[model samples]
Target: MSGPSLYNHFRTKDEILEAVADSVSALVDLSMFEDARDWRTALHEWAVSYRAALRDHPNIVPVLARGPGRRPAALRLADAVYGAMVEAGWPPAQATSVGALMRYFIMGSALGSFAGGFVDDASAYDPADYPHLGQAHLLAEQQEKIDERAFEAGLTALLDGLALQYEQARATT
Candidate 1:
């Protein structure tokens, strides 16, 4: 599938990139947004699903990182998140922020992650030089768990903050 054969399906780089983004976006579990009772729960589920999908197709993460553009699947994802948030009582602006914020978290995770950035050398972190990073050398070996935990922590913090903001807005309204 090299050269002309591949080019037959995608004549231009933009077309190829758009196709990749669409295909990857289709893997995400947008259905999570449909039946959940709370926006927080729905967004949490969707984010987890989105991250899982991205993990499997990490090479496409950069393409997905670009805003929805004109891709149908990508736009649907954007619409679903923003719509779900607004329907759940988020202000329009806040809903947009939720979409952007979630994208950054999920796509950033799919892109080369902090935990995975460490070299897997036991002596990389010298005791005297990196007193605080005694266990840092193990990070590469534990990249999966570390990345998952980091995602969970980030998602939790984001949702908690949004929940508080939503509550305050509701109280005032």
Candidate 2:
């Protein structure tokens, strides 16, 4: 179905997006992030789930890339991330940074993958002329593996940074 037809079926973009987001979010293991009493465990699991969900649904790329407010799914995910950070004992300031990092990591990686929307068909570059592009394409071919590492590295760094911030907050209080 076309965009217009889809939109007509739904009252507004927000409603459609919310339904889409709700469907996707339901598939995720939210308990992994919420149930973990330890902050590290929750953060790590949340990161892993976010990246995995993004990777699995390449079609949601346009929704996510459009902007947080434009897509209910993105907004829902953002809220969850921020909520998780708060539950982990992060300060309000740190919540924004931490959620932003997770969003950036997942969406940026999704965009990097050729699987996502908006293919650059106009830009043609020879692998011989641009080795980096060529190598990137090869890596994109193995997106699942790359996604795992990206999630792990990004999650570890985010958690470590948040941990430091929490310590600072503790020190002051």
Candidate 3:
């Protein structure tokens, strides 16, 4: 039923999928430390670009959520990230894991930020019912927080940990 509805509206999933893939691919090429030769710079560039893309096209999250194996663009993006890590001298297995981790973190955080209904201040009520959430909501209002800086910081920390692992592995082998 869903397939026919989707098909009637469009040719195939790939039809819509390709547009997203193309946009993301072009954006990745434009950003992601294209001018820099170092992997650390490339990694930072990739993170910034990924965050910007997610912010620009919050609707694309569902499509990308299908996983790299099922989505050509996602597969290509994953391949590029891992390939860059490998080119930086990390082993293939480590590169693959770290790439996957970075993608998952960025994608998940984007979804959380834009998905709606998750953290709306208007929905916050019954302080005694959900004490912790209510307190956080109050704190958010008090702090006037406008963006997910923590998410970006956590992603950086995760990449830092992966870089450490890469260094250790390189030392051993």
lDDT at position 108, candidate 1: 82
Better of 1 and 2 by TM-score: 1
C-alpha lDDT of all candidate models, in order: 0.87, 0.65, 0.68
| Cα-based lDDT at residue 42, candidate 3 | 80
Q: Where's the lowest-lDDT run of ten residues in candidate 2?
A: 114-123
RMSD of 1: 1.4
Model 3: what TM-score?
0.71
RMSD, one per candidate, in order = 1.4, 5.1, 4.8
Question: Per-residue alpha-carbon lDDT of model 2 for 1-173, expressed as tens digits?
Answer: 88899977799987786667556654555565556567667667766676567667766656665556645445666677778777777777878887777667667766554332223332444667765664343454565665566657766887798688788876886
lDDT: worst 10-residue window of model 1: 1-10
lDDT of candidate 2?
0.65
For each candidate, give its TM-score against the true structure. Answer: 0.93, 0.65, 0.71
The TM-score-based order of candidates, best leading, equals 1, 3, 2
Q: Is candidate 1 or candidate 2 better by lDDT?
A: 1
Residues 75-151 of candidate 3 have per-residue lDDT tens digits of 66777787788888888887888777777787777675432334446366566777666544444443314345666
